[model samples]
Target: MKKFTFKIFAVAITLLLSTSLSLELLAQSAGYEVLFDGGSLEKWRSKSTPSSPIKGWKVEDGMLFMEGEGGGDIITKDKYGDFELVFEFNLTEKANSGIKYFVDTIYNEKSGEMKVNGPEYQIIDDYNYEGVKEDPNGTTSTGAAYLFYPPKNKQLNPHGEWNKGKIVAKGKKVSHWLNGKKLVSYTRGSKDYLKKKTANKFKDDKNYGELKEGHILITDHGDKVFFRNIKIKKL
Candidate 1:
């Protein structure tokens, strides 16, 4: 009878362990809204003309990808304020692309033009890409904020392999992560930010990075790049 009791007890322990493991996996996947699932583009639109249909971008083998020409920047239709975003990306040799956030598209009635731009999270082959090497500093390296806050201790996978990217924005604090490492962190609208904005290429723009809520953008930049598993969670 004692031996039988011991067997039952061991079975109960095993069941509990399995249950806990399942719950852990479920928890890790919670609180995310999938923007792209490798199947559709219902959540994205052309940044220049919001009402126009997206062109040149395609999904192949469960990955969103574009050629090295013609394809333009695409943005999320829904705007977000203070959120965490995750995505996986693969690049070709010497490829260049970017993920831009706090994107505000303003139509200029006076100039009869449409303008869309924002601070970009740089994406490129850091070692082989000419853009990084041409720069005196590594400000335009793979994980750096383009021409602004530079990421530290960069670690990127090979051009053909997929790499993980995370961007977290909560109030004034914003951070960029690549391959599970935190690379860039900065305070929005701080003195440092203002100083840099004043001198950057966006100096002419009145509201370059001042939006409290804005759309997320993926730039084409005439480079072949692939993306998948794009998800976000509001914070």
Candidate 2:
């Protein structure tokens, strides 16, 4: 009986190891690379000064969180042309933040700050935030493309709860997803997009939203927010 029990335990251990190996292989085959899994910020850098270490952002209790404002923005060191990005975020009450892709540096003459420019996947406290409460369906709301495209059929978890966010950019088409639901999709340089760009604040900038390859940015919107499990798969 003792020998039989030992054999069974050995088999169970073998099965568990096999399962873990299979999952790891599957992720590699699917081209998924982990950018952050609560470990290191080696893959990211400050957007304004790439040479300097990140400021105002902390990694604690297995989470990469913005403690308070002035973190400046953080961006991935490598650039991607077409890819899929997935992350999880938790917002404080009335917090505002975003995940931006196809990011390029632009000199803001008004602020005298070199800012990263791109289309943003809005992350905010949708219920209590005054801006989102005022226009629940507007482009500024959570899951929207930040003044460019508004999400439809949006369902947002309340602040303090984790929400899954996804962005897929394949060719000229990009789509935003939240909590397994697709909220917005648009093609770059499409006629409708051009019309919307002309009507918005980016109209004066000819190269706005026209970049083909750029970094991924996490905005610092002067609020405390938590992020984790950031992964990207190049497509």
Candidate 3:
């Protein structure tokens, strides 16, 4: 009788564990996919690589690393029209970089296959990022949207430390987050959105906000910047 009771309890315990695991998996943010896994570039295409193919972007010590100068920006192989992307990034001291989406790549007469006309999530040394002026809004810091919008808080950690970031875009909804706190949100192409874009320097660029779908781009702004845990979900 004791043995039978023990067997029943073991089965119950196993079932409980299985259910708990399932719940945890389900709780994860849906419609998202991993862009990098510290292993291989399964969904990336380099515009700089032609013919023999260019391959220098790689993963090292669990962080994505880029080698040499003029490697060009790494972009998603598949274009995304609407998405919510989340990733972690750490910049070297005095590092400069950015994350841009819905960007159109253009080959100019001088520069070949360069990304143009996209809203950028400005990434830089918060304490040292330049050209910020005191304005009506109190968010003119490093994390601002390069002049259009400003983050509500400056919660980014120190240099060389991992920090969480997120970009959410669906229909007309777009949001930027850092360290689990929402910084700014606005519609992409609504009347108000277009009006604001016109008011800003992006006004002259007709390509601005015209792309309903485009490639996600990680900017290599001529600095040593490290990124990891990059993932995104379709919304």
Q: Per-residue lDDT tens digits of candidate 1, residues 116-183?
A: 76778899988688768898766788888888888887789979999999999999789999998999
lDDT (Cα atoms) of all candidates against the true structure = 0.85, 0.86, 0.73
Query: lDDT score of model 2?
Result: 0.86
- In candidate 3 the C-alpha lDDT for residue 220 amounts to 74
User: Can you tell me which runs of candidate 1 are displaced by over 4 Å?
Assistant: 1-29, 110-112
Model 2 vs truth, CA RMSD: 4.9
lDDT of 2 by residue, 64-153 (tens): 888866888899999889999999999899998899999887667888677666888999898888888788448998899888899888
Candidate 2 TM-score over all chains jointly: 0.85
Measured by TM-score, the strongest candidate is 1
**Which 10 successive residues of model 1 have the least lDDT summed?**
19-28
Candidate 1, 13: how far from true, in Å?
36
Best by lDDT: 2
**Residue 67 lDDT, candidate 1, scale 0-100:** 50
What is the alpha-carbon lDDT of model 1 when measured against the actual structure?
0.85
Clashing pairs in 1: none
Candidate 2 residue 143 C-alpha distance from true site, Å: 0.7
When 1 and 3 are scored with TM-score, the better candidate is 1
